[model samples]
Target: MPPTDGTPSDTDVRASTGKKRIPKACNPCRHSKVKCDEQRPSCTRCQTLKKTCIYVEKPKTAEEQKIEDLEQEVLVLRQQLQTQRDTESSIVVSQPQRLMGQRPPEITSPDSNASLNHSSPTWTSDKPLKRKRSHFRMQKEVAVPDFINEGILSEPQALHYFNSFFEGCDRYVPIFDGSDGFAAVRLRSSLLLNAICAVGCGISGDASVDSRILHVRLKRWLTTVILSTHAQSLETVQALLVMACWMPERSLILAIATRMAVELQLDDAFDRLVNLSISRPDTPETHILMKSARTWFLLLNLEQILQVDAGNLVDLRIKGVRRCRTLLNRPFSSRLDARLFSQVELNRLRAKVNETLTSHSDDLLQAVQEARVDIDVWYQDWKRIMEASPLSESELPSLIANLTVQRHWAEAMAACRAVRATGVHQVEMMSPEAHDMLVIAKEALQNHLYVMLSQPHYLANFRYAMDFVWAKCAFSFLLLLKLTILLPDVARQDLLGQGRALLNELTKSSGYGSSKVYLRLLQLTIKKYASRDQTHSGELDAFIPEEFIFEWDFPGLNLFSSPTGWDMLFDQYMIGDDLFVGMDI
Candidate 1:
């Protein structure tokens, strides 16, 4: 069927666009703004985009309207033809109908095509297939070596090793034994071994060794010595305590050991001498030894208490006064004066004891009452000593410096003042060793004041101590500096002055080695201050020797890691929000 006119038919034009135009009843391509060639079913644009080719009803142009009507008629004819073909195919396939009961053929209308498009893909496979077998290689077993022999040592060998390693050492001599003591030793040794073993346990890196066992051993040792009551065991306990006190990084251990010593009433032995007649006229040597022993005990007591409860400043001061009174009661031979009557010595002792009431406990009301009773007594004693064969003014500075080393700050200050009152600056100057003693005393007083100031109850006493020490150290340093610079023959007369000059010269000439030893005392004092206040950051820059700070390999410092030392210092120093903001360091 060619067209009557010479023009090509609409079907031929539709094939070029790969689309078909439809009637007004169903023309989705026209509404979708795609080119619709006049065909019955599918459109080119939907096919190209792989979208569902849907036919929806729409109005069409006159020419398109004619083509659409023809398409509907053609569709009806195709449906009839498909029905006839299906009937014929069924008849041919079922020629011997008796083999099975004849069944009617299922009818599918032209509209069924739309229903088929909506259905999902079938799940059944067309053919059945067998799976292939996979082969796996077997792994060989590994044999592990037995470690039982290495794991545990025999008891006798262990004991021999332990004794050989620990018995001769002053710090770890064994003093206890029971059924369990051997086991305790083994346990402690095992802990040490474990710590060593842990270092090698990790495959790729060193592991942290647990120090808890070591801490526990120290704690138990402290407890045993402190709580032991046997008189026979006191010597061993005392030895252990002394050793424990000397252990590095063991402040807590020392504190506990000291407490144990106090619990065992060892301090009472020293206190007992105050009541004894060791100062009898016939036994001057015994008196001296007793005095020395008492002094030693007092200092030890003070040191132990200071180590434990440094924050309890008022209690320490009170305890110090009580100890002083106890010492005063026992008159040393040195104080008797060979020419003085025994009664005079007794009277002087009474007066000295009375004078102690003035400095009683740093309490305001108590101090006032005690001062009125004691000031005259002290004044008389001072007058007697001053008038009768007084020490040379030149000797006072050296005496004071020695007293400072003995932890007698008040006596040292008095000696310094006495030397100063004589208008003899050159003799009053401190040598380098004397300077070191002065620094120690100054640091102790400052530490005492710092602790006192921290407590609200001791504020007034704190101020007094602070003012006294600050003025004393400042005046002494200034005097030393002035004398070192101004006095002729200073280097020959004063070792400390010469040391200072040497240090100055070294700094100027870049001689670091000689300066470092001299600067160590100052550096230690600075370290104490830093630890006290937790402020060691830039404060050490000026005090620590440049060579020591830069050249020495500080223990526990990791050079590869980012700087954590400074950060830790900042955390330790800053107390509260007051110093939190704008902290550049």
Candidate 2:
């Protein structure tokens, strides 16, 4: 069988193999129990028959078969488990409807297991929610622990507090639209509801209900439930926003709320809707989205105000201010929208002044002057809005009065910063800007004081006596005092008396809890100033005492804690007399 050539014969190769094994047969051959070469394209028998060539898989062994069965069983078991979960979810969802005739089980806390079923239904339902119970609202209905069910938070007292908020404080902040009344708040978030009540307690003069208990419980709930759970929602942001405006932990709360807002993309929602040309739906959900957009606007506005208050340029862009105004003009907006819009616009101008003051450019004075022009234009535009009579006799006259006061306050602040831009050293040698600052400051103080005194009822409201107003009063007082001390001839002495009267009225206002502290510190500073003789003033450095020249803080607020504590006043008097003897004002 061997070939003559070097190539080996098939029989010789087969013989060299000790035991030649036949290949596994293809499907056709295996059915007939015939041998196969295991060729891919065609078996020899199938090719001869001109039939389709097909190969079958090898049979699994006993162990492999057992493993395959186990895998199939696991897959079936997983599917069964999913089915069971779905059934349980359906039962839980239907249980509330099934017991519609009977009272549902009471929810002991916001974390109760039953509340999980309410989220999807509450948000997706298109029907008016007056008839239905929302998750938070339902939980609120049931009496909870002492913390949530006592004092101002109790059901009996909660309405009065909420009413006080809506009537007194809501006009200033304008967070709630007052469409569904308190239901809009209670249904949305228990935390937000509590925050609203706590803020309302500041204005609500209810003696029977102690506000201290409500405040303590709210703080507990904020830290333990909402913050610890890392809850994120539009309601939570609103709650945090409300708290930041009134709470002592303003900066920290604002930071956290703003971070959550970014995570929620609240600032982007309006632009996204506009870009996509998505028609807003006439549903509760759309209303919520619009409110969120407005919330973002208010957040933007307050952030800018705080930055300007701290004497720093706002890091956020001004476009949000514009967008917020547009959003406020949308349907469901309130008459108070104009007030908030005016504030945003005013703060925008203040931000520009702050930017110019912080810059080191040589044309800083010109830039500040230009900024002042814009501020003046703002006053001219909003003045009519501020002066227009309220549409209804029931509308709070203080709303317009407060806006007017804020406008004057904004102008004074702008002028004060402009004076800083002029780099003035002495009040005796005044530049155009310094003279303007003196006039504006005095006029603003007189205007606001007249408003407060002529309508002394304005002092009874929380908005008139809150921290910002108190700060304005304290700042105006200090500025006037310094000016009078520095230039007895140029500045009016009666302006100081007017400033003192304003502080006295503020202290007399029952709603301002910290007015005493504000007035007391100011009085001590004035006392210190009077103890020193300004008549012998060869140099203006000794006009203001060293203690009054630095950062000043109240008990709860860092009111005058800005590094530029005296701003232009610092340049004029805080420096050593040698540094500024020959400098031009």
Tell me the TM-score of model 1.
0.25
Every model: Cα RMSD to truth: 35.0, 13.0
lDDT of 1 by residue, 1-585 (tens): 544332334543463344554333213353454566534465565556554454433445699999989999878866775665556434522111111111223333444332110011212222334656569743342221111124433445444333432322211111222211434433333332221222112111212322233334434444443443321123333333333322333345445544544443334433444444444422443343343333234335434333222221212121333233333323342231211121122223333332342234233233333332343354344344424424224323322232222232232232232222233333234344333333333344433333332333222211112111222332233223222222323242343433344333322322111223323333332233334333322211111223223322111011111222443322322232232233221
lDDT, candidates in the order shown = 0.32, 0.56
lDDT of model 1 at position 30: 39
Top candidate when judged by lDDT against the true structure: 2
Question: Candidates' TM-scores?
Answer: 0.25, 0.61
What lDDT does model 1 reach?
Answer: 0.32
Clashing pairs in 2: none
Pairs of residues at least 3 apart in sequence or in different chains that clash in candidate 1: 20-39, 21-37, 21-38, 21-39, 25-57, 226-260, 431-496, 432-496
